[model samples]
Target: MVVDIFIPCFIDQFYPETGFSMVKVLEKAGVTVRYNKNQTCCGQIAFNSGFWDHAKAMGEKFIRDFKDCSHVVAPSASCVGMVRNYYDEMFYNSALHNEYRTLKKNIYEITDFLVNILNVKDTGATFNHVVTWHSSCASLREYGLKDEPGILLRHVRGLKLVEMEDKETCCGFGGMFSVKNEPVSTAMAAHKVEMALKTGAEYIVSTDSSCLMHMQGYISKHNIPLKTIHIVDILASGWEL
Candidate 1:
């Protein structure tokens, strides 16, 4: 019932509220939450940018940061995917191999932990707005998280969930992929927003804030009529509404 939260760079710097919301949702489920101040990047950014050396350095630090924790949960599937899937390549034969393996088994995406680990179907939330889910590539493909998010959202009171055109499509915020290909990334975000609008959704929700940030940037820059929100934020909100 005890867990440690791993907040990635994106959420720590930009969407700290989402990180706090995740902790709130977990605590609401009657679980003990711990924040490791020593935690840092999961080396995903460096790994995706093709800097394995720099990534390995941070990966070591990340492993050491959460080495003592029983369970490590993150708000980001992208970062969890990094730790669960990619850490092996860097620590396979190294001294940190065993520790990284343990980290992989212990880490869970917030929603995944809620539905699977915590066996929680609802967090007593009441978001009375239209929402369409965006399946980040990491959330859907890498982490293979499909129903956990939907299962949790369906339980929120007065929340209307709609299906978008490309529910399984990428939001174009593939970490370094966005920076390396701005036009394509923007086009992808635009397409995603267009699809969400078609659903008449008041918010585009996803577990990954990176995608939200990308779409929100486009939504803001072009003055679009759409908004973006993280899944944890939705779950943490609406009780006071």
Candidate 2:
């Protein structure tokens, strides 16, 4: 199937490799993926921070960018959740509401699209190391993406998926929450890192890069050996022992 890839701001600027890997995975799976250079922010930051007007404008731009595509997929669940669940509210009474609705239905998180639409579990990846999965709040509770990732991860040739304590707990990177409540955000991230380290996981994998970025900051500050990875990277690296 043909799909439009939505690379969030952070992923585009800081984690371009993940976007590249996502494209590789999709191409390998026999899907035609297109990247729209005009694509910009999903207006999630502003929307969540209570700036509906700014968010509406941003959402309008997003709709304009991908309105013609059959499906729009994002590497970050947080962004997917934003577009899928919040765009309508952000543009409810605006002229763009109809376009917003169309964009919302076509958007999908990478994992959700892979498992649900692609119908393929194993990406044929092989990373011979102990790893644990972190369920970001958006991907887990908001999008109800409980099994798609697991179904895919389990099939990696030599990867061992371990369960950590409080697997469903937020990594404490609630967008603006991290900036507004640094102390609380850091504390929760530290706790989440502690649990992942306790499992002796060589890597902490998740669907959201925001969580990984937050955890990585703490992991680096504290000199923790644990590594953070996006699910797309892992899937793309499939069975490469």
Candidate 3:
């Protein structure tokens, strides 16, 4: 199946390798992958920040950018959730309503697309490490993703998928929430890191790198004995670095 990947600003800016890994995993599963250079932000940041006008503008561009795509998959759940769930506020009953609806139905988060749509659980990935899954708030509540990521992780060779305390808890990286409430955000990240460390896990794996990025900052500042890795990176691991 041919799929277009929507690389969010978080992945495109910071964890670029993870984006490449996403492509590798999809290709390994025998799916055709395409990245549209014309694609930009999904207007989530603006939308979340209460800038409806700017958000709608960006959302319109995003919708038009992938208008012809059969299926649009994104590595970050938050980005996918923004489009699938939040775009309704700006586009519903509007001029772009029909187009927005089409995009919403066609877009999907990576794990959701892999396990549910593509029916792919194994991608020949081998990551010999004890890792815990961090179910980002958006992935769980907004995207309604529960067992999809776990299904894919279980098939990875040498990867022990341990459960983290409050895996469903928010990582406090609520986009603008992190910046607006620095102390609260930091404390939340600390709590999450402590939980992941308690599992004796070497890596805290998650679908949203924004969460990973937030936790990684705290982990690095305190020199915590843990690292953050995206599931795409883990799924693309196995045979190579």
lDDT of 1 by residue, 1-241 (tens): 7999999999999999998899889899999999988788988988998999999999999999999889999999989998889998899989998988888899999999899888999999999899999999999889989799999999999999999999888888888888889999989988999999999989999999998999999999999888999999989987676
Model 2 per-residue lDDT tens digits across residues 75-177: 9888888887887676787787787788788889998898888887877777777899999999987777978999988988778999999999988999999
Task: Give the lDDT ranking, best first.
Answer: 3, 1, 2
Q: Worst 10-residue stretch by lDDT in candidate 1?
A: 232-241
Give the alpha carbon lDDT tens digit for every residue of 1-241 in model 3.
8999999999999989999999998998898999899889999999999999999999999999998888999998899999989999898998999988999899999999989888999888888999999999999999999899999999999999999889999889999999999999999999999999999999999999999999999999999999999999998986764
Off by over 4 Å in 2: 238-241
Question: CA lDDT of 158 in candidate 1?
Answer: 90
Root-mean-square deviation of Cα positions for candidate 2 versus the true structure, in angstroms: 1.2
* Deviating ranges (above 4 Å) for candidate 1: none
Cα lDDT listed for each candidate = 0.91, 0.89, 0.92
